[model samples]
Target: MREARPLPQYLVQRYHGWRATAFVENRVWYRRLADDGQHPRAMVIACCDSRVHVTSIFGADTGEFFIHRNIANLVPPYAPDGEQHGTSAAVEYAVNTLKVAHIVVVGHTNCGGVQGCHAMCSGHAPELEEKSSFVGRWMDILRPGYERVTPLPPEQQIRELERQAVLISLENLMTFPFVKMAVESGNLSLHGVLHDIAEGMLEQYDHQAGGFAPIV
Candidate 1:
């Protein structure tokens, strides 16, 4: 029988390496902010992708962005649906306690979650339904986006899916009363960012330019 420990031996070894690294670079940050608490300038809603870490992509220093990540970096609309809502709670804490000024819904290209959603929606991948996985429910968040791009070309459809996912998450941010009040009062602002992982490029939504612009 396997040891009842949560981590296997190799994982434990890698974690030990990470811990040693944490002791070096992260020590100063943990000392300064851990006792004082999280005071970040921005709150980033990012994906739980192995390649899309917000801290590393933006080169964030300690406590730079209060991050909330899920399968697809979703923020479900605020509702008393009798479910444990970790994302909503984190958003609330970021807005109410940390009082962060910016909330960025950071989406990325070549997202497998988005791909799964598109494949399921198009009805070509019926096998996805057999797994009884959270992928089904998580992909539901992209329903509105799916409806918007059904008739477009394959390339444009995928782009629309990714872009709309970010915009809808931005909309969901306003479902929280505190987030709404903060944005309305100019205490907070919202953004939709698209990160291209393969190209290692970052794009920011430029309202004036009417599209995404490369990070300068």
Candidate 2:
């Protein structure tokens, strides 16, 4: 086994500071959470982009939201091929085990993964089309979304594709039997949100309106 190295000084200092402040200040709350385990009411599937802060977006406290982050916040269609499905696994656990009432798939503007998918589909990123590229394979999930938005102007395609990522995930969530049953029974609700990284604005998908509208 490879030997593990010590954490960097900056991270160690940050940990110490957090431990001394937030951890110490909320010792009892933290202890209660540790003892009882988390029972978050909502599950947020968000992009792996560091700029998209799930907790901060909702002003959520620790243990309040079950979050899963992945490239472009995409969720592949339900496939039981007996292979590892990290995103699907998280969705199953959140819906079946945690019994979360809401599942929110959050996408963001200026997503690198989405841009890469656009490039690959547009034949601008031939390297990602290689068989060995994990990103290329994983990005197959967004191909349908990209196809649907292909008619738009070049400048608008990527941004629309980003929103489609959220919509696609929300649709894919229903592919899971448990997720479908929960939604059908009115026990679960699915939401799609797009975050504007530049303006720090949030737009929510309105089923009735059939498009995203800025939240106030």
Candidate 3:
């Protein structure tokens, strides 16, 4: 095993500050949460982008959401091949164990992952095409999305691809038998949304509308 060093001074200081203020201010709530265990009502599958603050965006409090983040917020098709699947594991726990009523897939504008997919699909990103590149393989999940938006202008295609990320994840979530059963039996619902980072706006997917509409 590699020898590990302590946390950087800035992060350590920030943690201390949070411990002193936020933790102290909500000590009772924190303790109660610990004693009761979590009962979050929703499971949020979001991107690993630091700029997208899931809690802040939803104004969520502690234990309000069970969040799973990964590159591009991609959820691969359900495959029960005896292999490690972090995202699938999280989804299974959330739906079957936690019984969350809502599963929300959140994608954001100007997503680097989406951009990389566009580049790779357009045959521009050779580095990401390597078989050994984990990122390349992961972004492959969104290739269909890229293909869907190919006829559009460059800027429009990128924006639509971001929304497609959320849509694709929502579709993949249903590929899980448990998720499909839960939805079919009225125990769970799936949702998709795109967050416009610079504009501070959110557009939700409306099945009836067949596209994303701003959250009024």
TM-score of 1: 0.87
Question: Where does the lowest 10-residue lDDT sum fall in candidate 2?
Answer: 1-10
Of the two candidates 1 and 3, the one with more favorable lDDT, higher being better, is: 3
Q: Please write out the lDDT profile of model 1 over residues 144-210, one tens digit for every residue.
A: 8889888898879987788778877887888888889999999999998888988888887877997
Candidate ranking (TM-score, best to worst):
2, 3, 1
Cα RMSD for candidates in order: 2.6, 0.8, 0.9
Candidate structures ordered by lDDT, highest first: 3, 2, 1
Task: Report lDDT (CA) for all predictions.
Answer: 0.84, 0.95, 0.95
The runs of at least 3 residues in candidate 3 whose Cα sits more than 4 Å from the true structure, single-residue gaps closed, are none
Candidate 2 local lDDT, 1-216, one digit each (tens): 478889999999999999999999999999999999999999999999999998998999999999999999999999999999999999999999999999999999999999999999999999899999999999989999999999999889999999999999988988999999999999999999999989999999999999999999
| lDDT score, candidate 2 | 0.95
lDDT of 1: 0.84
Tell me which of candidates 1 and 2 scores higher on TM-score.
2
Q: Give one digit per residue, the lDDT tens place, for model 3 in 98-197.
A: 9999999999999999999999999999999999989999999999999899999887999999989999999999899999999999999999999999
Clashes of each: 0, 0, 0
- Identify the candidate with maximal lDDT: 3
Query: How does residue 174 of candidate 1 score in lDDT?
Result: 86
